[model samples]
Target: MAPVSALSRLPTGAKLFITLSIALLLLALIAIGATLQTGRLADSEVRARLRIAANESARNIAIELSGDINALRVAVAALRGDPADAPSCARAQGVFAQQATIGTRFSIVDRSGRLLCGVPLDTRIPDDRDDPVDVRILNHRGLIVTVAAPGGAPIARVVFPTAFLARLVGSGSRAMPLGTALIDEDHSLELTSIPGQGPLERTETVQTDLGLGGLQLRTSIRSAPITSPFLVALLLPLLMWAAAAGLSWFIVDRLLIRPLRLLRASVAAYTPGEVIDPGKLGPLPAQEIRELGDTFRAISRTVALHEAGLADAVVRQTKLTREVHHRVKNNLQVISSLINFHARGAPSADATAAYASIQRRVDALAVVHRNHFAEMEENRGLNLRSVIGELASNIRATAPEGAGSLHIALDVDPFLVNQDVAVAVAFLVTETIELAMTCDPAAQIRVAVKPGDEEKRAKLRVVSRAFVESETLTHLLSTRYGRVMEGLSRQLRTPLHHDPMTGAYEIAFPVMGRD
Candidate 1:
């Protein structure tokens, strides 16, 4: 069987119905059990009452029989000194004349069981005393009480008719639902209120002591079942169950089910991204449902306000970004112009070349700044080949008088880097070209960029056909220019390699992606 706790899975209405049903069922069972128990108690009470009635009847009979025996003893005492002859017997009969009745005779028997004297005498009785009994109940006749005379005269027997015992038990009353019998010690039925009413269902018996021995008065009562009475009593519990069920349904519907249904309907109709009106749900008697509706309305209002604020912030941030990039582009153009003017005013060839190189580096910055503003939305830094092409053009534009034929060839892979790192790379290329011009001034320069050992790193190679190999140039690279390039390499977090045999200058560095 499933565990009882699975009942919790039932709906609210079903749970209420089942709970009330179980409670009523138990109450009905208890009522039936108690009613059956009461029936048993009633049966017991009837048995006790019947036994008491039989005992009382036997006691009354004993009292009356005792009185009769006393009267016979008195008569025998009166004849104590008289002779046991004809006149004596006649006198004895005259003495007991007042006590003669039907089923009760004043008879005197001698020591040999002979009838000595009698009132209304009949000679049919034999002079035999073969069997003796103290209290003898005769079949359909009477109750017999035999006793010996007080002075050892013949035995005197008092016979009380069956009508007397019937009167003692009140057999005619409707309250007495019993059949009564007077029985001997051997359980032989001598006299009964109902002579042939089959066997009794329930019997109670009491033993009574007469002068000779004892007799049993057995009374039996029929069974009185509780089924009919229990059925009659069940109407009250049925009515109780009806009342409880009605009240429970009323309370559950009013306080719980109806309100919950309303709440569910309101929730299903709700739309997201919109403020909900608390008034839509109106009111509910249940406190928790009312509070839940209030909470939902508050949440919708808060979300709407937060979304409005976020939109405003995005608009302000975009405007500020465009203004900053515009100012930066204008400033870079002015700096490039100033560097060109300074180069034209130089007095010597070496000083003019130096100024032109500085102007080229400035122009590289201006080109990068323009590209940055153009692709700001892409945010992928600067394209490596585009920056290199801008740097090569700037170098060719600033070439000295006869060196205008100097050509820079480019073979570069596509990649991206942030503004700062791209500028650092341009400066490194500018320095390599200046170093090539210092060695042969007329050599062609080749610059190329490609993927490095890992995806996030890239190598830039600058090769030149310069054979000058000036010792002073080596000294400048080691002492002065070495520090600037090494510092740039440290900022880019990569090492720079210089190969004099191939005139190959290479730097490998981690590239930062913008998107």
Candidate 2:
């Protein structure tokens, strides 16, 4: 059988855990992707809203600053009417005050850095600058716009309060939470403070043509609220997925895997001739599992019934076989008695010897049947040592009167042969011993059954002077005895070997046991 792998040996729970873990990992990846996509959408939406707010704030700042610049230009034109004398500060201030809105102030200075006109007598003119129109931010006076002539000399300066610019930038209602700031791009200065206080997450800038120097508006927003919704969206599904996976594992383990494990255990413990009991498993969680267990129990019961029937049939056959062998053995004994009775009445010695020979052969067969019957329970085969030994003893006891002093020696090894082989071995031994006694009345017959050259084989050898090529033995071979021995050897499936020099008759036969 092939060996099972380590992975295959793992329990159902461990395999389920691995499967669930892989699913959870995929779900985690999906959650992360969803969270990233949600954050991108929020950022895009916030960016769009911030862009609109910044654009709107920049436009308002630009429009307010444009009006202030145009008013200053009108004041400058009014002053340019007289070129001979410097415009009177009182007259210039009067023209600017009429056009200027509340919280607005103006200062007019000549090419020599002397104050030419002012709304207030103590109004300070800003330093000379090059741009025709420039905007600056002051901490106390909001935005300052300086107008200079084509000669690169400042002609006038307008001061717009920071409160007025803040009002212009804060004109409209916002769709989202945000902060706004008006910046002087030239100086990198903030004209108005951003609306909200703490650190901002997103910021956008919009440039405006204020007819002065560089000026722009910045809009910013915090993303804490957006982040809260994104986290909820990402976590909600993941939690649900985990719960569902856990529930699935629990259901499968209880309803399917656990009941199957129990059924497997019961099957492993099953033995032949015993009916399997599905009720040992108690109540199963699933109907399918219950049905499977019941099916297995039914199959096991059917097999057990068949096995019982086969066992009973085998017992009956064994009894019948043994009875047949017993009857045959009894009949052989009766025939031996009849032969004894007939030989007792024979008048000639030759006839008496013939009867003795027939009795010996009959006894040999009887011995084989007895041994075979004895070993039938195991069917291992008859013991060669016992068969040959008993045969040798019987031949010596029934020796002719003159050959009564015959010395027959038995040296046999313990080996087993089937009934057929045992019969052949017995007959061969009986013939050789009888021939030896007939040729030499006092012959020392040596019978040996020993391990053969090949495995599971044994050599039955009869060593005596009768096997030699003597005239008496040759004359005896002309009778039916020599042919009978040959026939027995053939039955054993091996040629009988006679060594003239050693005076031994040998033939090999198969044995049940190893050498």
Candidate 3:
């Protein structure tokens, strides 16, 4: 016999292994392909854009504020008194207009840092009145530059619109592809092109002096997944597939394939006639295969035990049957001998004939019993061939004197029947031969037992040429003797039929063990 490999025994291990291997490989390929094709981060371009935008806006603001301070100095020099009392600070107003600036609010303040004219009286100016140009942010007002007189002390402050800063910051076309934010030195947002609530991937920041003393302009270029649909679509399922395949392989190997291998090993070690100790197998993984192993191990142990005891049980049963048949034969022999002794003391010829007939029937039963023990060692059941052959001899021995020795011939087939049914068949054949004998003392009876109809039934025929006219046998068959033969036929579940022309009595019945 060829040795079985451990892998071959696992019902689905190979298929599952191949399937998982292919799946994981495919997922890896997809991830690799997507990674190779995917675009890289926009950090370099974003940093440059941010730096340029911040620098350009800062430079523009510084130049404009410097120019505004020089112009405001001329206005301060042209005035002789507080501009708050002047109907028109006409010269300063004209200079502001000449700058062609929009959304500019101007205020004149004294050396004391009190707002004097040209703007809201409630406006408070910064205390740094000595500087030529000082940029400051007031609470309600947005961005302002404070300018002192070019020759002296009186100062003028100009506040610019938020749009002015926006135009300068957003001046470059590619400044921020996704978005940009301008943060003040105070960490407050000065301007933004997109919201800041989402997760942000920020590039290198750009900081440039706004010519506003310590206040600097900081620009950061940032983006989010919401800004890139292609990246999201390309990478999401790839990551998911990789994760799923990894998790699936781990679970299938641990819970399914590993346990399957263990089960295969356990089963391969099993031998048919030897009981397997369930304890020899260790705890299996928690899976359906574990339940299957437990069931098979239990069944194998139970079947092995049954196989071990079966031979002994057969020997004991056969011995008991042989012993029972032996005692039955002895008892039948005793009965046959008693009938013979009575035959000798019969008072008349008719009484002697009656005792002899009784003796013949007892002898027939004794022959059946004898055959059962004779074939006991080969004990399956009675072989009909051997049993019928023996009965022909017994019938010839018990024939009455002066009737010339009975000549019986058999044409029998090889078949087996159990003890009880074999006895019935034996008796039926005996009674048949006896009836033929009574019909003709000089008769040669031919008994045939052969397979019929696919071996499911057996046909038995008793024919005698001596009873050609059928006068005596026909009369005997219509009498009480016929009823006894009929009863035997019914017990065998087969009916007897005689053909008048051939002088053959035929019966067909089912045989046990023929199948």
Candidate 4:
């Protein structure tokens, strides 16, 4: 892949668009995840409610059938306890026959288990108690459910969820089947739809003994599954994602991308030297793009003014060059005349000393004039080579060389310095070299010119090799030379590096860029 920085340099609008698109995609993914989790939770909750409802229905049916059978068993016992031919016994049988459906039918058996009177009086039931259950079940019960059958008096058996309950069982497609059975004192099918068996059944015998043989209660179990009802179950997350994408597009269009496009257009038309009046554009509110437009306008105004001022300054500088040249001619003539007067008169050694002293001052003044004249001729600055070489030549001739020859060399990127800086350097070099020569004439002194290393961070070095060995010179460098060098470095927007190793002084400063 290309470097991220290379791609970043593409227009800001493109960057913003890509970023916005990515943000929207991430938002969509998050929404979908949240939705799915919510749907799962919702499903669980709904299923729990359904399960509870199903259990309630099943339990209610069991209780109703059991209660009815209990009532009938009490009535039958009252009739049997009376005389066998008694009108009450016959009346009880008549009442039973009137209410007899297969669900309510019952048989009264003698102590030998022989049928006495009722529907299925001659029929036999399956011996499920002796038959092993094929599938194991989690719960078990004997005959009665929610209550016990009265011990041995009158046996009653009942099945729950008659056809009537099934008719009202469900609301639309959510219906589930639930059935149950209970036995009481009256041994009969107290609540049942018909005589045949249903496809699904759960039968359990309550282990507690009844007054008669064991009785069974059969029930069907059904439940709804559980899960979360709010987020994913409703598909709400998809709607939110679609809405967020629309918002992202709207935001990028009105607030971010369009302004950047306008800025790009303005930058395309910009050029350095040519005059432009961005003022033709009107003022705007202080948003970033508007502020940028205002900055461009100000920059155009400043650049135009600068170009005109530079052209005018060029012509004025040409005129000043000629005037400086005339002044230099006058100063040289005066110095020449003074030297001639001194030569014509021969006095004592003291007199000669005084004359030489006067000549030295004149030479100093002449160096100053030469530098000024050079600056004027250049129009904008002083030539570095000319100024340095001239100063070095002057120092070799007059600065009381004690015991040695002086070596001076200079190097650079072949450039010039500002007039003021160049003149100061020229004077500084001359004074420093003179000070060195006065110390020891026999000393091997070297001044070399070389380009500064860009990686070195220091610009230039004016090295005086032997002077650094002197404690006095070290003090002068620290207190005086250091301050002067630092001031000049600041003015030039650079740094000076000074290293004094034994007798050597290597001073380096940051280089000014060549014009």
Best-fitting candidate, scored by TM-score = 2
The worst-scoring run of ten residues by lDDT in candidate 1 lies at: 120-129
lDDT of 3 by residue, 411-477 (tens): 8887777777777787788787777777778788999988876566788888987546567877887
Query: Any idea what lDDT model 1 has?
Result: 0.69
Q: Report the error of model 3 at residue 85, Å.
A: 62
Candidate ordering by lDDT (highest first) = 2, 1, 3, 4
Q: State the displacement of the C-alpha of residue 44, model 4, in Å, after optimal TM-score superposition.
A: 22
Off by over 4 Å in 2: 1-40, 54-220, 223-229, 288-309
Q: For model 3, what is the C-alpha lDDT against the true structure?
A: 0.68
Go through the candidates in order and give the clash count of each. 0, 1, 0, 46
- Ranked by TM-score from best down, the candidates are 2, 3, 1, 4
| Poorest stretch of ten by lDDT in candidate 4 | 131-140
TM-score of each: 0.48, 0.66, 0.51, 0.43
Q: Using lDDT as the measure, name the better of candidate 1 and candidate 2.
A: 2
Highest lDDT against the true fold, candidate = 2
Candidate 4 on 1-515: residue-level lDDT in tens? 57698777876655655676667667777877776676556556645554554455445543444444554455446534632424533553565453344233444433345333343332233333422111111122212211112334233232222343343222213243333343433443322222223444322222222222334333333322222344344455556655665677667656656555556666678776564443344343337767777677688778868877887897787778677777776877587567648844847655653554455445555665665565554455555566666666655564442433566665544345555555455544544554455444445555544455664233344556556667766665676555664565565555544455644434443334343
The per-model lDDT (C-alpha) reads: 0.69, 0.75, 0.68, 0.48
Residue lDDT tens for model 1, 413-463: 778888888888988888778777766667888999888888788899888
Residue 333 in candidate 1, Cα distance off native in Å = 0.6
Clashing pairs in 2: 89-117
Q: Please report the TM-score between candidate 1 and the true structure.
A: 0.48
TM-score of 3: 0.51
